[model samples]
Target: MYSSLTEIFKILGIVSIGSFSIVGLCAFLFKKLFDYYLKEELARTQSNLQLKNEKLKIEIESTKQNKILAFKTLHEERALLIKDLYSKLYLLKVEYEKIKLQETSLSFEQLNSIEKECIEIQKVVGLNRLYLTKSISENLNELIKKFERTNEILKDLFSIGENTFSSMSEVSNYKPDQEEIEILHEKLISLISDIIELLDKLEESFKLLLNIE
Candidate 1:
């Protein structure tokens, strides 16, 4: 009977040990799986964050490049406009010199041509005035006014019919009073000097703007 009791006790102890081993094994496996899955999730989240950062950097770079390109294009366009204005002024200056030196009677066609040139210069300056400095624009306006004044002086000296042109094709062959011509010629000389001075100023301004030495 004692042996039977001892045998039953031994069986119960073995069963208890087996149950504890199984529980420990299950707990170890659960902890290992949990750790592995946590690590994978953290690694995936970090990777996603890195990719997002890279994408953001690319977007920022693209925006910067776009701004630079836009500015460069605008600068080039402004430079072209300035060059165009300079050419127009140069042509006007040549015309002024020719008119000043000419001894023949002034034709209506010549006056009309000069008026058209002035109009064209005004149009160019007015249209792109925003690209120029305020001082430059004001000087240009003053230059136009001087050009118109010179034209009016010429018309007054030459025109016979009410001192105004009635036809662009008409030629004014009537000689202006010699004394009046001399007086007005002095005025013309002064105006031409002013025009040359203004031209010099504008050239310097343009040079500064274009970074020319």
Candidate 2:
């Protein structure tokens, strides 16, 4: 009996050690699998984040480029409008000088032509006033009014009908009555001075808008 009990105890001890070894092996394997899966998931998350950052950068750059292009287009258009308006103003000035210096009696055709040109100038200003500063717009209107006044003065001088010359060369050779020619000539000179001043102001305003030194 004593020998048999000792044998039974040794068997139980062997069995317990084998069961513990199996449990320990299973726990170690589980830890290794968990670590590997955790590393893979973290790497995936980091790659997704990097892709998102790259996409965001591209969108922002595209927006910036579009704004720059829009600004460039606006500047070019504004410059063209200003240049065109100035050229028209110069033509109007030439017309006024012609009426002021013409030696012959002004024809109805000449009067109508000046009026038509003035209307066209006004139309341009009214349509493209957005491109001009408020002060410039107002001054342009004033300049057109002066053109009208000059045309009216020319009509009055033509109505006097006392003197007629074939050529502008004869204007300096003939002296006119003080009451009529002197007054009209003085008015014309004053209007010309005003027109010049307004032109200078318009030029300064354009320089400011274009950021010119």
Candidate 3:
């Protein structure tokens, strides 16, 4: 009976050691699997962050390019406006000088020719004024309206001159007074000066719009 008991005790000790080893192996495997899963999750999160960062950089670049394009467009438009304004002013000056010259040489045919040229100049100036007023910024609308009103007054004055020239062409006895001609010339000069001042202001406004000031 003593011998049997010893053998059973030895068997039980071996079984306990085997169970402990199995449990330890299972715990080690579980730890390794948990660590591997955590590493995969961290890697995915890092990749997502990198993609978002790259997307933001691309968006920033696109916005910068759009801003540059917009500024370039504005600059080009301002240049065109300046060119048109200068041309109109020059043409108006030439027309005024022609009218002044007509006073010295009093020929009906010459007056008619000068009147035709003046009409053409007025047409061009009118078109330019329309464009200028249309293209002006909202901030300058009041100033633009003032200039437009002045342009309308000039247009009326030119129309009166045209009618007077027509009447003079038809009637040979009609002669304009020297003093009246001189006064009209002075008024024309004053109007031209006002237009030039407005154009200078418009240029300054454009510069401000471009943030160049």
Candidate 4:
């Protein structure tokens, strides 16, 4: 009976150890599976975040490009209008000089008609006044007033002086406020330069801004 009891205890000890080993193996496998699942979840989350970040970057870049393109388009259109208007002023300057000098082949009647009906430049200003910068628009209006005033002064000189345009150009006494006329010419030249410079700067800035195209 003593030996049998000892043998029974030994068998029970072996059975207990076998059960513990099985439990430990199961626990180890479960732990490994859990760890693998955790790592996969973390990787997936990181990939999702990376995708979102890339998409957001693309969206921001697209928005910036759209704004830049819009600005370029608007300025390009405005520049064309400004260029045409500037050219009109140049033509007006030529016609004005003609009238001021009373050049041959053009009757005073024709020049007087041109002076009175110098509405083309005014019309261009009125139509696109909103497009022009405030300084440029105001300066152009002031120049127009000066042009008319200068024409009136030249007309007065022609009436007082008794000679043709060729001889009249040499008469220093007939010139009323010649220095003032010179100043007006300078201002007009400056304005033309300003318009040209502004347009050129806009174009150059657009080119420099976009390296992609």
Winner by lDDT? 1
Q: Write down the RMSD of all candidates, one decimal each.
A: 4.1, 5.4, 5.9, 8.2
Sliding window of 10 residues with minimal summed lDDT for model 3: 135-144
Error of 3 at 177 (Å): 2.6
lDDT of each: 0.78, 0.74, 0.60, 0.63
Best by TM-score: 1
Q: Global lDDT for candidate 2? A: 0.74
Please provide, for model 2 over 121-168, each residue's C-alpha lDDT reduced to its tens digit, 9 standing for 90 to 100: 789888988877887788888877877777777766665233655654
Question: For residues 122-200, what per-residue lDDT tens digits would candidate 3 score against the true structure?
Answer: 5544554544444443323443344345444434434334455566444444445667567666765665565566567
Ten residues in a row with the worst lDDT in model 1? 160-169
Please provide the root mean square deviation of candidate 2 (C-alpha atoms, Å). 5.4
List residue ranges in candidate 2 displaced over 4 A.
Answer: 1-32, 102-105, 156-183, 201-213
Positional deviation of residue 191's Cα in model 1 after best superposition, in angstroms: 4.4
TM-score of predicted structure 3: 0.61
* TM-score (all chains, Cα) for each model: 0.71, 0.67, 0.61, 0.58
Q: Give the clashing pairs for model 1.
A: none
Q: Could you tell which candidate, 2 or 3, scores higher by lDDT?
A: 2
Name the better of 1 and 4 by TM-score.
Answer: 1
Q: What TM-score number comes out for model 1?
A: 0.71
